[model samples]
Target: MSNKILIVDEDSKIRKVARVYLEKEGYDVLSAENGVRALKEVCESEISLILIDVKIFTMNWIEACLKIRKNNVIPIIFMFNEIENINAVQVLPSVMGDYIKKPFNSEELIEIVKLRIKRYKISPSYQKLDKINIEIGSLTINRDTRQVFIANNTVRLTQKEFDILELLASNKGIVFSIEKIYEKIWGDVFFESDNTVMVHIRKIREKIEEEPENPRYIRTVWGVGYRI
Candidate 1:
């Protein structure tokens, strides 16, 4: 069966919007107006992933996520307004698969959903590329294990972060404009001021560079893009 996605929110409009776009991407979309209905759907359906609002009308999002996670391994993506403590949500009982800030554009939402679901279905062993490793400065990348190291320390990175690092490191010294990088990695047209790629780049630098403000490996080209 095609992967099924559940969108749980009290607002019918949000559910409809999410469902329409998700369905367009060839996913089987299901939605619940409240946590009770959401949990019921989880019990009855083979849900592949869940997109939940932080504030549901009937229950707290973290509570609902914790309840569902007690039994299911389905990936959960939190949808929250900018006002919420987004970073704090990461420490909830169950792992939050991902989060999207409020007022997200359709393309951005879909991209995040696609990447998260892709990671969910693919095993780590299979996600790794064949026998390729790169070493630059203090950074070491092992494509076989999809891991990065700075000196003797292993630097933890999200899939997207690893992908970005791999791209820049593999083609060392090649300047990649933000738009080009987005298109190559995301397989989509880049949009203006989409900070998604930029955010990941910053995070990757913090993990790999000794000093992010004065990055040694990943260098910025001012008005252009980034290179290593």
Candidate 2:
């Protein structure tokens, strides 16, 4: 299943906290403050599921949901507050629920997101890639098999190495910071002293990259991070 989720909420604090939690579970999360930007994200990105606030003050999100339903069929989980009346969502067939109430716990949010993403995949209308593969130059990654091949020769990688590579390869242009990479792969908080991601990147380059010192597939952005 795709590990990309979008959180649509006007509250910056909510978005940040939810982002941190979801990233720990290896999800690449995108956020939008209101319906306009949220609709733009849904159109541009392959968002596996959407966690939208029931009350979007910036714009009418119910209208957004209706618009989304016209084209896409991804899971739409509502984040509602106790005081807000979510009766409008009743007409939305795509709404998984309005169960995520305000003052919600992170665990509940994560659980609901996971369940919806998994459950929605069961639909016959949802298209599944026959072969989940990523190819960059000579490097070919079969995500389903968790295998990497360099010009027909299988390249052996440690589990972490493969995870890092797949993370970068799957999101080609996006540069992930060392901290972000460490958290997503290790599923733990990264300390400043930790060079774990750097070490793993080196090992992956040695195996798949023709020249480890001057890598082709995984390029390091000076002082930023790595990207494919």
lDDT (tens digit, per residue) of candidate 1 on 1-228 = 457789988778888888888888888888998788887777655567889887762336457667766644578888887655565664565656678876677898889888877776674432332235576765678776676767535688999899999999888889999999999889998989798889999998898887899999999999999999
CA error at residue 19 for candidate 2, angstroms? 0.7
For candidate 2, the TM-score is 0.54
Candidate 1 to native Cα RMSD, angstroms: 18.8
Candidate lDDT values, in order: 0.77, 0.79
lDDT of 2: 0.79
Runs in model 1 lying further than 4 Å from the true structure: 57-64, 85-93, 124-228
> Model 2, 1-228: lDDT tens per residue?
335788988899889988898999888899999888988877655567888787773336666677767665688777877644576555565644536886678799888888887776776545443236676776778776687877645688999999999999999999999999999999999999999999999999899878899999999998899999
